[model samples]
Target: MKAALMYGPNDIRVELTKKPDCPEDGLILKIMAVGLCGSDIRNLTSDSRKGNYPFIYGHEIVGCVDEIGPKQTKYKVGQRLFLFPGTYCMECDNCISGHSENCENEHVAKLAGTGGFAQYIAVGGEKIHYGGIYEIPDHVSYEAASLGEPMTSVFACLENAKIGYPDTLVIIGAGPIGDFMASIAKTRGAKRIIMVDLNAHRLEMAKQFGVDEIIVSKLDNPQFAIDEVLRLTGGKGADKVISATPANATQAQSLHMVKKGGLVVFFGGVPKGSMTELDTNLIHYNNIWIKGHFGASYDQSKRAFALACSDDFPADKFITHILPLDEINHGIELTKTGEAIKVVLHPWDESFYP
Candidate 1:
């Protein structure tokens, strides 16, 4: 098997490696499509979540079952599956409370020396049952199924904010996360979906994804965008505001864009030591609700997969670039430069892509 091994920050090598054996009560998966995530780039640049050196670093995965171990009755050989990616210990308090995404031992599945970046990887260990694997529906394409992991986080944020029909939902970011948030909000009956970003190209792309309005923020003057949002919302502000970008200013602006008693979801995390100013008076007087969402639980992953399979979700539009495993480094670079919305990797055939 050939795997792309990351030896350290900014260092990755594609080399022949031994394939992993099927774990007891688990399934060995043949890599099909894996999407590059922002977190993966963070590891290569900031080294924030670099767990171990010489490790494979990919989590958004879609693969077919190649080998099924004994007692694995829930799945079979040749069955396509999408991974939840975050392995957890079911005995932890978080897992018992239905928040397995935050389980005490939660980590990328590569700690076991196998990851989606490889040709084949093993899944299902003693404590990996909570959200490790999900079978892809026949109607969903491999590219759409590979997006299951990141889409779960967007669904989780909406759940945290308790978004519902007829609400004016504002998403601050036009990247892949914001794209998913906009589509999900529109399908859930949001009356007016407003997407804000500094990138005009992304805002143009957002128009194709069902957003009611688009605001291209002025890089030097965010206030102009804030005023425009207020104007669109009739001076009351949006019913729900989601800051999906990590910019500190955007996080702060969410408070001003939300209506009285509205819910503002902080969907992205800024770098450590970075701080944003907040007006506590708004929360005290207008009763605003600020919610922070991190990861998605097992149940949320299932819901995201169902949504991806739906006919109206426009799942295919999410994939903007496709490359072979040998060119994963280029995919990662495209993601950082905002040149690609979502990049999918094909481990089997380097030359096949539609």
Candidate 2:
């Protein structure tokens, strides 16, 4: 087996390793594709020395069950699957309270081990199911399955905000995650969807998925964009404003763009100790709800995987790069630029090694 391991800042190398064997209650996957996530980049360059070196970083994954342990024979030798990389301790107070992702025993995940970057992984326990291992539908592309985590995170945000049909929606950051939120917003019947982002290319990428009404973030009159949003909503502002960008400005922008009694969501992760001040009046006067959604619930994995495998979202459109294991460094570099929407590592790509 071959995999890429992160040693330090801006460094990765391909190495040979023994294939992982399935645990008694687990399965083994032959990784097919994995998407580069913002967190991965953060881990690469985080100021903290907490990151585990010689680590595998990918988490957004799509692959197939190559084999299964005796107890997991229900999953066969050739099932296409998407993994829920989160593993929660079921005995924890939070898990006992049915808040698995919030399990008190589980410390925050700063780095992902056994990453999707490798050619194979031994999948197990709570890490494998809410319902069960998802069998990808024939119609779903590998790229869509790779989006399981990103879409699931967006779904968690929607749940937190309670966004519904006939609501006006404004999304900050037209990045891949933001665009995924827009896709879901439209699917949920949002009355009007306005997307805001700094990248024209990302806005253009959103169009590839058939979204319109994007506001470019680079303008002196950022308020003009908000004004257009207000105008689109008959001057009441949006019912829901989501900041899928990690920037503090994006979150602040969401506050200003939403109407009184509207929901403001931060669906993207801000680093540790990062802080921002908001006008307290908005909370008191407008009755606005400021909500932050972190990772997805372990209990939602089965449903998320099904949705990840569903035909509804054209998730394949999200993948912009697919490289072999040895070229994984290139994949990471591509994702570093705002331009590469999604980059997947294919350990099996023959060109990577030769």
Candidate 3:
């Protein structure tokens, strides 16, 4: 099968490999759709990691089960499934505490880990234990099902937020993650959700997603935008501000937009050593809560998968481009250049999209 792999920096090669075997209790998946994420681009550029070289980089993945494990319990052949890419060992301390996303065991990721760019890949036992293989509802198309990962991450942040009905929710950045956070905020019954972004086009796109207001930070000045949100909330800034952009600057901006006692969720993946400047007085005097969220819990992935496949909430608008796996470079470039809102890589034939 043909697989797109990362040999090193700026080197994504598509080559043939022996078809992966299905794990004893796992499933062999035929790659259908995978989303190209900002982190994938970051791996190619600013924050590349070592040791994990010659690896497959995709995490937002959806596929149909080709070969089922002989001792299958919940999964079967011919079923479409979503993946919780970060495999975790069930016996670890974190896993015992229901934080399986951080299991210390290497096999947690399994031998045949996230090779979603390939035509076929195997899932591990930890993945299955964590409900990693969620059945894609028959009603959901492959394209939309691929958004499960992003939605799960957004759900994780919201869970950390402890949002209440009619609370004002502010989301920083209008990228896919930001837009997703906005949608999640809306679904949670936020009375006023303000979406902040530098791209006017994205703000316009956010309008289509039903945000209460759109703020172009570079032009409208984000503080002014926050003031408007406070006005909308009767002079008490947003109840919660979720910073979903990787930029450290946006983290500080979230502090400014949230009220004195408001909650702030930093959901973006910032590089190591990145720092955001904040007011020390506010930290000492005000009772604001700044929560940091990382990967999604396995249970959250179930909800996110349901949300992804649901049309009532609607995430089709999130997918702005689709390209064949062989043309993955174009899709990744779209993310780097901000030329595409969301890019779905199709390992299957192109006819499925057009």
Quantify all predictions' global Cα lDDT against the true fold: 0.82, 0.72, 0.76
Candidate 2 clash pair list: none
Worst 10 residues of 3 by lDDT: 106-115
Indicate whether candidate 1 or candidate 3 has the larger TM-score: 1
For all predicted structures, in order, the TM-scores are 0.89, 0.86, 0.88
Candidate 1: give the clashing pairs.
Answer: none
Cα RMSD of all models vs. native, in order, equals 2.7, 3.4, 2.9
Best candidate according to TM-score: 1
Residues 160-239 of candidate 2 have per-residue lDDT tens digits of: 67767888788888777877777777777776678887777778778665465787765566566677777777888888
Model 1 per-residue lDDT tens digits across residues 1-354? 988888887888888989988887888889898888877777666665455677787888888989988867777899998877666666778888998777787354333323778899887654245456777888788988888788888888787677778899999999889998888877777888999998888888888778889999998997988998999999999999999987889988899899999988888878778888898998779899988888877788788877776786777788998899898888887777777888889888678453
Which pairs clash in model 3? none
Considering summed lDDT, which 10 consecutive residues are worst modelled in model 2? 105-114
* Number of backbone clashes in candidate 3: 0
Error of 3 at 16 (Å): 2.8
**Which residues of candidate 1, in runs, are more than 4 Å off?**
49-52, 70-74, 87-97, 104-114, 352-354
Model 2's number of clashes is: 0
Model 2, runs deviating above 4 Å: 21-25, 47-51, 67-74, 89-98, 107-114, 125-132, 219-228, 231-234, 352-354
lDDT of 1 at 221: 93
